[model samples]
Target: MLSTSGTIIGIDSSTGACSIAVCRGGTMLAHFHEDMTRGQSERLAPMAEAGLAAAGLGFPDLDAIAVTRGPGSFTGLRIGMAFAKGLGQALGIPVFGVTGFDAVARAVFATEAAAGHGIAVILESRRADLFLQIYTTGGAPDGPPVALPPEDIAARLCQEGAAPLLLAGDAADKVLAVLDQASAAMLRSSLITAPDAREVALIGLEMAGDGDIPPALQPLYLRAPDVTAPRAG
Candidate 1:
């Protein structure tokens, strides 16, 4: 492992936001967050530059980079990954990839450690379905990520047993609405709406300390792109 004093940077543009964070050891040095479902490709670099400037660091000074590789918007994931990998390659530093699901789950796990119940990190797919994953209290995933219809979430959680469900990510409210009042009572809303770069920084720090290398930086897609070429007009 590099010196604990080295700085780590994390990025999240896997959904509607472009977020950048700089951290040292286990503490956040700086972060920039903004929501723009479009134009992430344009905003990412400037945001990274400004965030680092705010933190009084530069790209060359960066020790590692963490970017969310997701089961969210395809274009958004592509933009984020391209920028992060380019930066990491240029700086010759390790680029860590964190999943959107795990980012939210890990954040909630930190805040609600007493919740032996479990956390569901749901990413809104802008359809009747959602990109979802469940994490036990210890922060390890209970299962692999899957694309699930929002209507099925409540029943699916029930299938997992009676552990209280802590719902997080931007689509939490939709999942709650699908449940009956009694079942809804079993769910507790998490403070995070979407996974933020601040949490990503802390996560990167933990991975670094534990000497765990995250997955390779790439777009993690749950579904095919909505666009396709028209044939034979």
Candidate 2:
């Protein structure tokens, strides 16, 4: 089991970004990010090694590993999870899973301007739907994550009666057109486009402290997979 002050590493390759971070006692020691629409598998390992190197650590030094468990690119998620699990297995450390919403909410709460505001993390699917979740002002998630269309997302938040809502994720802008004047006024969007591995590390630290780590790492596929395997001979 990871101690409260244990060192943790977070990895996220679940979107356009491939990120890695090392954290100790809730503080991020080092992190690396590469922005690419694809090819995360090629970069994730070196990035992870670099982050560990930057932190003056090695795989065996980690007490736990955390990773964004999906609701983003299918290939990206698989690549990240595999790397994280491999590290955990090799180093004999625990591996935990985090959601995109958890990362976004942690990042939002990390901002001073977002203090005391509810949050809605909206990750866009390649299809017409979105992956959504809510967190209260203090960064505690309110409920389970769900999927909805852009219009329904706007309407649902309105029904939830969350005022001064802090919005993050790439598809946040799409929900704006469908929001009523009152709903729009009730919400405030942030600059975060997608979840970051640093935030994943931060939240992972908390989860480690609180002993809230997941039993297993699994992809949070809000929708069906976007890719189909090519026919083999």
Candidate 3:
């Protein structure tokens, strides 16, 4: 368990956006987010500096670091994890890893809109398939997240049930398109949403307080990257 009342900085560059937040005692002191498909490596540190400045705090004041350990953009995930680990190492502070699923699901669980609805989180893979996880109305994961074609995902959700469902994440619409008309008709969506660092901080604090921090924060890549091998020498 954490010794202090928790002053932490959360960083997320797991999707198209780069975001950072500073929270002390479970309240956000400052946050910054910008949507960009690239340039997180160049911009993340300056943005962290800005968040610290806006919060009227400095690096020495932080008790821990929290970051999204992703099933997200491969490049984006590395940018965030590297920044958080480097800073934590330099400052001698523990770093906590929160999943991309929990980061976005936290927002949905807090809203009244989520009542009476199962949640299906669909993350973009920048490929033909997508990353998906389902949650009960009360916010427990139905199973592990997986990368699957839209049709397969639709089939799985149908097996789960056809109750009113809420679809979330950047790729919600693509899943909506592939669902059977019955499932499609009972759905609501929050397509503009992406994982935000503000929630990352809160979730991290909860994880730490419960002594759930991992020994190592590894990237939660749902599938391998789409890299091409170089030509033979």
Error in Å for residue 145 of model 1: 0.7
Scored by CA lDDT, what does every candidate get?
A: 0.81, 0.85, 0.87
Candidate closest to the true structure, highest lDDT: 3
The TM-score obtained by model 1 is: 0.92
The sequence of per-residue lDDT tens digits that candidate 2 reaches over residues 92-115 is: 777889888888877877788688
Please provide, for model 1 over 105-149, each residue's C-alpha lDDT reduced to its tens digit, 9 standing for 90 to 100.
777777744367688888888887888898876777888888888
TM-score per model over all chains? 0.92, 0.91, 0.94
Tens digit of lDDT per residue, candidate 3, span 94-128? 89998888888888888888888888888888899
Candidate 3 Cα outliers beyond 4 Å, as residue runs: 160-163
Candidate 2, after superposition: displacement of residue 167 in Å?
1.2
Candidates ranked by lDDT: 3, 2, 1
Error of 3 at 86 (Å): 0.5
Ranking by TM-score: 3, 1, 2
Tell me model 3's lDDT, rounded to 2 decimals: 0.87
Give the root-mean-square deviation of each candidate in angstroms: 1.9, 2.2, 1.6
Comparing 1 with 3 on TM-score, the higher-scoring candidate is 3
